[model samples]
Target chain A: MHYTEQSHTFRKIIMTKRITLADVAADAGVSAKTVSDVIHHRGRMREETRERVRNSMRALGYTTNLAARTLRTGSAKLIGLAIPNFAQPFNGNYADIVTSYAWAKGYRVSITTYHRLSQGLRELSADAYRFGVDGWIFLTDTPIPAQDNFLNQDRPVVLTGDYLSHGVADTIMFPNVEASQTATTRLFELGCERIGFIGAPANADSLDVTTQQLDAALTAQEGNSAMRLRGHLTALLQHNRSPLPSLVGACTRLDRSDGEKATLRLLDAGAQFDALFCANDAVALGAMSALTSRGLRIPEDVQIIGFDNTPDAAFSSPRLTTIDPFTEQYAQMAVDCLISRLEGDETAPTVHITDFALIERDSTRH
Target chain B: MHYTEQSHTFRKIIMTKRITLADVAADAGVSAKTVSDVIHHRGRMREETRERVRNSMRALGYTTNLAARTLRTGSAKLIGLAIPNFAQPFNGNYADIVTSYAWAKGYRVSITTYHRLSQGLRELSADAYRFGVDGWIFLTDTPIPAQDNFLNQDRPVVLTGDYLSHGVADTIMFPNVEASQTATTRLFELGCERIGFIGAPANADSLDVTTQQLDAALTAQEGNSAMRLRGHLTALLQHNRSPLPSLVGACTRLDRSDGEKATLRLLDAGAQFDALFCANDAVALGAMSALTSRGLRIPEDVQIIGFDNTPDAAFSSPRLTTIDPFTEQYAQMAVDCLISRLEGDETAPTVHITDFALIERDSTRH
Candidate 1:
């Protein structure tokens, strides 16, 4: 839809079957992607090869139809939702909710995944237009820096996650600090003395503290793990408790296996605790498996609290009690914010945090 | 890359920062999408809108730069991986494995999800081009009909799943029948007198069998559930055990919650079985949760086996016994097939199925 060429011979092709880019590529003795590269002048090739491809294009009349018809129909009212690969339960679960809300708001959602974390933010959604979206909603695990102009690279953008966007774009965040604090506080109220924590930016080998020590940690740090750990620490300090490094476990990722292995290592090291505050529900579920496998009972021998409150939390054995950060409402607000931006609301970009609640279940004492 | 326009006065644009589509949109008093539609000639709009957007484009000199620069560079060889959604363990888990293999083979992978089950095959692929995919590897749950041509719409396509493609495209299939049959037969060898099953197409409300009578069921059906069920039935018939309707639980989805509720329903209905053959790992995990919640010992009381030996299976309490469908190998084969097609293999599309094995864990007695 963004381009047009003048005065092409429209009648050079056969009508029996529609000619394709691959058909032209075969005739030119090149790949279809090569033919595409030539069509878009994407990468420079030898002039002779370009002529041969152009000749095949003319002979098949492919350019007049298939190649020229490559423009996406702009009528699709599309929104691009970008997620870092869907291995973790929260990423896919949140994406499903966002797609539903986006569709209900009369827009079709297309997904694009960012893989290989080492590629960094330059690779994070700097190419939304190529994937064909009028705007983008990037639910990222990476932290956005102050000058993160990738936020609004020509399209109205909404950034979600526990990262601080510095208002470079509209942001949606979970109450990583507040809710973790509250979850820890609740475990105390449930009659827990020593509490263990899982998930930090450290490896499973004895799990390093993000700061030199937990007491000196930045409560407003830039990661989900670090911030949540800070909140947990705050609650411990408030209760006049000395920090137990043995009770804190670290994970490389927030996946279930990560949780299970980390929990096993803690148990192997004899890191005893009456309660556990996990990073997310996936980790919590796996930790429960670890505890149960050892004949430990939930809410009696060791109480547990998880975050995110994913569908799995509700169905887990003992019905996992979790911190619900109002995911549905957060999804709705994000869509509305993006729609407002698309509708010419030039107001300064803002940060949005949804309300949180402790969803009590059988995993915790009443 | 398929479009170009010439001789526009680009000097009118501001030199300080790159002009964005939203900027032009704001100046033209239209949504960025509306400006996009006007630029693309996507659909019919009021003539007045067309004129106003053109005026804004001319005024801002946006046409000479940003709008004309929408072409994607063909340098990046890319593939599209389509799955139902990432919420399912198999979907996301399989996708991550495919992405790694695709990247190693020098292809960037993009994802697009198909939501709303009622949308069907017309929505299945038919529009891979609009999503800017060079080719697609569709891991679909929907069955493809005999005359399905969405396989190759100008671009090379590869379809993977239990569903038959009627040789419409290059296919990578799991040995659903053989592996499942083996899984059930092993339970009998392990001295299980009665076996329970979860995951049929029917709902949790007294799960319905596909055929009116189990004996008349089509051994060669089109779905993962039906085919796997047929394999189980073949094993039962081999052992001369009458199929117990109450022991057969049905699930609309193969998610964790669905498995939990279905297992509870079967147990509540007094369906006594010595073993349980679950459809997938997510289902198996949940079923285990249900049994454990009910105070039942794992292998001693009820031997359980699951499909898709996901990472979760290794860490699950009792360490779940599962059918190893060679997911990583399946991913490699699929990538190799697509690459061959891209490099112009020109051979007849072949059906490929990966080998399988029962990985004995604590959930099953060795």
Candidate 2:
């Protein structure tokens, strides 16, 4: 044999190509459709032939394209969700709950965080348009009125809580004001003489009108706010309690460090308050940590109440007595509403409100 | 006037619009271009005219579409990034670091999380394709294998540590095996005779390779791995050694309750162990909590070490000794690589490995 002929015969003998689906069908004396059906484990194949096909598929290396299958079904099975920030424990919990819920619904959630509330809302609206999210749930904190405009335009958007005003997007609102009022009232019912408030002043200024309303209803004081100082004094005087001095204001910052510093400032100022009501759990926890270091016994010397029943409340060394704002319920309801909107339910923006309950724990047992 | 005549007069009045830009220029005694410049806040406009134009805009409620302004400049000012399992603490930190970095660069990052690893990769790749992300940084638990044919097709992709195989996309990896070897060696230096190992089994298997290498380097009669019989033999041979056996097991199921139960089982089985080397901070914390509950003092009685120096590690009751895997560094590097690729850098895959350092805290110090 010539050299070229010898080389060609050697190449043919050495390179044994792997069997394809076509080869399997030809060898099995069946149509390519039958081979494909057997490969996919679709239907109606005899056991012996199924076994033969399965072995053949293994012998060959064939991978199915899931994307093609998904395209055929017209479902990408994905949902896009965004939140303001995840660094905060509460928002982290929110992201976690929404993700778990979305997963249970056979849809995957894509989560992104935005920092500035104004920017977050605009990005959310635009992202929903650019990214083909089945729907969107915005766990927002933007108090800007423009947030409403962007949300209204975003249509199929869900608002996690009363964090934003309604009539812009479908809203899931927690009874924040009601919860705060209830938390304040619980202290009074426990025979507390004087109560001081510690929270970020900036947050207090942006206080939702409903929260303002709840404060008004609870104390029977009507104005921009239910003056905690005035309420404490009125309660003291009306109940024939010992005459009290004006309430001392703690720093308005709501973070853990702020709470700690505020408590220290209150202590330093010689504020004769019997109970302390914190703006949120972080403030309460920080205050407790400070008080503990000062050798003060909680509920004996001072009763403390916190807002937002965070998961940390249960795990704290001395579990905190706080308000349960039902954020998860609000989130779930928001998802439901947004899904409806995405399904073409163009109902006028409606607000869903969930109630709050006071959870009495070791910290406030008088 | 009759109602129809009154309506016609009102419509005529409404149609009589305000002065146009030309009228503003003529009134202000400037060119139309100068008036337009003043209105748009162009740099060349005089400060006085700019103030006049600002006042006019406010009076007229002239709402500028910021999005349109960006389009005029051909910039969206947004980048879409995806990560797997943002709920995981490490991924959460990763997201925060990258978000801040992106913000510093004057770009907003739209984040999404995919729970299932491979599926997340596919969805993220698709998201990049459809959403027109300025760029993408794909953080995964595993490197994108070329054989993951769907992912190999195209798009700007960067892989982070966990899977460090060669011939893949631009990759960054943590030197986990190297770090584990160093951590293990440190334990030996600290006079820990019976070191128990616990972590995800696959991670433990990789550590086993490191331990084997260490044995060869040390040239000691002791084997890197301690089988039950081998542990018993070592204890029997060393006169002062406790009659306890070391264990290498899975950390996947190790939570607080599981730690308590597992410790009880090990204690009941009379397995003597002095030190535990955990896979992650969470497992280490659980193990430490169990040991202390059993009246065992850490380090003095049973030293503990963990991987992944998460924030909670330092704040842990008995601050866990953990390996700082440079997670932020890894995330930043991954972002840079993705940006470079987006900027049209076609360099071969560059592997960046971050060295791990042990943070000695309360748990590891007697």
Candidate 3:
């Protein structure tokens, strides 16, 4: 496949021009991709073709400009990650893990806050071409809309969160319901007859959720809140106990302050509970504060469990017992999927659910 | 004001050509920048020149290819932020604020973790052109070395941390010593004496530092640990009290676990202290756990204060009283400085020190 080209004519023309991959390709009588394959030592190319491209590159004096290739081809080795702001420990922990995993896969990450109230994936589609990222990893709280073809952007997308992806993109999630059920069952095993739930999806802030409302939420099953609520209720039902409305504290958001308000609302209603299962560590920490303010001691008087074994959980008073959702593995899965897609993998979109562990601490009895 | 060109010839020439800004400029007898200004409705230009460019655009049927301009010029309007992992609340808070401010100023942020132990700013300069960031803001632990000229990156550099910038880049810092001193003095004003310091920069894990060690560390004035330790000692000295070696707890890091370990070490040495001033809220939380474990009541027996009014500080039982270093303002300044430089401002590198406030809560007396 050695090209018998007249090198003299090509050399003279290249003297007045910056020799590009296209010039090398034309000289070698190969595609531009073959020239690039030879330069990067990547892709399947014949040995004879690689040699011809190399000889042409040397004759044309072509130097590969990394920036030029990126600009001209619009193929920046960059991954855009959209997560909620880092006030929540889960968001920060996930962001930290994603950055390491993205870099390890040879892609730099561009992170942005995906404020759900103000914007959605549908909005990003309007200007996705402007961002210049090869692919995207969106850790969204809301399930991406399938009707809008939100996942059908110019670049491939991989989602990481406890949300349904509508079979549109590669998704990474943890077993929210299963983990919540396991936590609840553990509390019951520890002889806790009345286990309250904090951070249940309330229709409004601090509203007492009715059984009818709970049923509707469960049937819809749109988010982690409903899924987690179902798990808590199932555990109680399996134990031959019915859930009490007062014990099920409802809050619109999952923050420490929200947890505190929920716990206070339960207390004000004279809800007698020996244990609490919160949506996240932040809410659990707030619950601890509310309980402590009322002179109820942890573990001895009331047991508490949190999710997302964040760093704060390890240091919280009583060293909050929490569910370790394996954020590291989840991040790794998301990055690997996105990278594979960028490298031309056309596999069917798959769902990746990471395993979880119950981290026992002073917050709960052994 | 309209261009008086051979309309038929120009229209025919542009009919086969996808009209570019350069084509419009040539038709109007102006520069490409003038055409850009007219399109964006920005920059100071004569009304006649604007009209001429607009008319040329209309006549030549020139549609703006925004992606083409960005790709060819390599102006992505992106800002790179290098920070430590988000396990630390301060890092997360700073990152959250930076994202909001950067977005408000019409720049998207690309974030990466800067591991001080592995890489430095000088290392980034080697590949700054590849990341496509217009400028960078580094939230670093180690002060940038002056000799390396790390500040002379291809993109502008802004720093936000406790470390000195060697006057190499615009730096955002909080008053560590002054804020720590104010926190200590507030405890004293509330009728507390024998205040203990936790999270000093010990040479090794749990190594006791002598007065000589303290003096040397103060003279160095490097990171938050040393600065915070100095403020505690200075406050004691100002109150005509000499700090007892046994009362000062030493730790290599400022994590919550480190705080707990340091508190235990002081207690084991039989140090009698009525108050404690911790390095950060994390350390303070750990200290709270330690005191509570030993039956030491907060405010009643051992009032405590912490630095960095993190979300954890607000929810801790006895609701930790800490110094609010104004993270919002610090992030704002860092992003603004970096954006200013990216927009071609050539002001001398300056130091920005944000103000601090001592937040009173249940951890301290009113």
Candidate 4:
């Protein structure tokens, strides 16, 4: 454990060649151990001796292999963080948090981004092996690659996002579907009828299983679209009451551009919706612009709700009502998962699904 | 280059023996060379033979020795992109670009962020050795680590933004001083002279040499507070010699928040400059917001110019007139410098500086 043989090599070379530690020790007239201790500065050496060793080391090109020593002990002092992309604000903050966290732990982190999902996941696994990282935390949107056919290097991998249906890896995910259901139920209780939904379509290409589950939960309460409408019409006929209007259609890709087009299309179709629910703040912002351009007042003409409580949401023209996806909580959870795995918590692949909160602002006051 | 001796002790016995090339070749009834060509998909292997080898490989569970091969060749296929932080929008895009570029080149990029300047440089040097990165491209705002004694590891280290001071390393920088001169000269040519500066203090803390150079360049032409005020006073010396107005003091930090605060303070101080030149677009935006809030029309009342033609500059309310800092071009040059070093071009360290372009937009076109 002491690596005394390598220390002998250091002693032999420094003894014969340029300025020997003995020469400095003779000048200072201290024991070689004292000089070595002073050179390493690891233990108690007189401050004066320490300064003299510091000057002696500098005077004689003494670059100790502390880094190499750490490496030889099978610990690279490195952690790996992988993300889908660094462009999105959410992922950007995620990258920042992981970097800060690793730095705080006295370990340096090396991050890698992959554009192609599968390749990203696979490459990260390969990197874990080649880099000999202490552990890996993957905040990715890609599916897990095949395991039996993996490169056969053993290392712990923690996946962020619970939509891990692959049944192969440990994961941490936010409760996306339950949160959406909660938001919808709250809107229904707010005496709002004829609510229109504007968001990206739930489809295979989207691959958002969490959102799809939310749609199912909502549909269960409202009944199938056509059947629900028919049932509402029947109830109305009996009570001489008007039927409630339902979501018209979901837009695919909920960016501002998508919101603008979707809003215009909804207005042109003469849908009498009193409230609009958007998938994210960017879409809601666009919808608000479109409605205001048409002289409709927020919560007066129509109410709007958005998801993803981004920082900008709080400061927009009319403060946006959104769901706090708790990106920080998610990031913390991912880190915890990775750390646990690295510590050998190999109890079957675990999943953590966090809850979401709805933050009400001026947009949804009605 | 051929590893014919496949009889390492570790390879001979294992708890669960892994399939190897010889097993796959034996299963396919072909030489290992034929299987190698099929696996690498190198030259021509008959479709029938390729399929036989592939099936045999699958049946035997053969895995490639890419790690061993990389170790043998000293090409780990990893590159390092060092940045100040990952969250800043500008540097975020830089990280993304380098990652995308490296991936396209069939190499992986590891990112290292240094929150503090010294710690970052130390980690970068250590990582260069530990991670087996072939080259390094450093885009930092602070000075390179003084203790970067990488004489032991002569891996390529190319820098951006004139960050390195005494270290003998390759660096790429933009013409910050010349660009500031150009921005000021262009304003001078615009005929309105009651100009005031609104930006971070002339001496920003922890700034690199290029920043100091830019400050010198701006001050060189009429270069002091009194001279600047005199230039502004001369502009108004034309009401038939118009009455001169006093120039304002420099604002520090040069961000949107600081810009707005400085603008409000200047307005409160009754500074009556006809034109305002800001440190950057963020400052210009903040100033524009303050002006709009005070009902002061742009160009009609106060023409403004800014530096750093960021993406949003072209889309600002009255599009911002700015200096195109060419961040992307900077990134490309840093990459070229790093690749050249990785490919063994350790020519004398030279400063690679590119020019900035003056982007005339709505803010400056009276």
State which candidate has the highest lDDT: 3
In candidate 3, stretches whose alpha carbon ends up further than 4 angstroms from where it belongs are: A1-65, A72-76, A123-132, A204-206, A220-222, B1-68, B71-74, B204-206
Compared with the real two-chain complex, what DockQ does model 4 have? 0.21
Recovered fraction of real interface contacts per model: 0.26, 0.12, 0.30, 0.21
Go through the candidates in order and give the C-alpha RMSD of each one to the true structure: 12.4, 12.5, 10.2, 9.7
DockQ scores of the candidates:
0.16, 0.11, 0.18, 0.21
How do the residues A1-366 of candidate 4 rate in per-residue lDDT, one tens digit apiece?
A: 122222322221122233456766665556778876764547886676666655444333332232233334545667777776654445656777776766665666777776643444554654453554666777655344343323223556667733352445566776555555455555555656666666634345642223334334333321112222232233333444333332443445455556666777678767777777676675676788778767788877788777767644654445678778787777677676666666678677777766678899878874
Q: Could you tell which candidate, 2 or 3, scores higher by lDDT? A: 3
* Cα shift from native, residue B254, model 3 (Å): 2.0
RMSD of 4: 9.7
lDDT of 3 by residue, B231-307 (tens): 87888889998767777777765778888989988888888999999989988989998998898999899999999
The sequence of per-residue lDDT tens digits that candidate 1 reaches over residues A238-280 is 9988667788878887888778888888899888899999998
Worst 10 residues of 2 chain B by lDDT: B6-15
lDDT of 4 by residue, B69-185 (tens): 444466666788877674344566677767776666666777777764244554455445455567778765544444534322446677664554344677677665566556655
Q: What is the per-residue lDDT of model 3 for residues A1-366, given as tens digits with 9 covering 90 to 100?
A: 354343322222114456678887898899998878776668997788888886676445453254445556667687887777776888887887788777777777766665522444443433344455677898777666555445654468898777777777898888788888999999999989899999888775438788776656445454777777888887888898877777888876688889999999899889999999998898899899899989999999999999889888877777899989888898999999998999999888999888999999999988
lDDT (Cα, 0-100) at A188 in candidate 4: 56
Give Cα distance to truth, residue B148, candidate 1, Å. 5.2
lDDT of model 2 at position A310? 68
Docking class of 1: incorrect
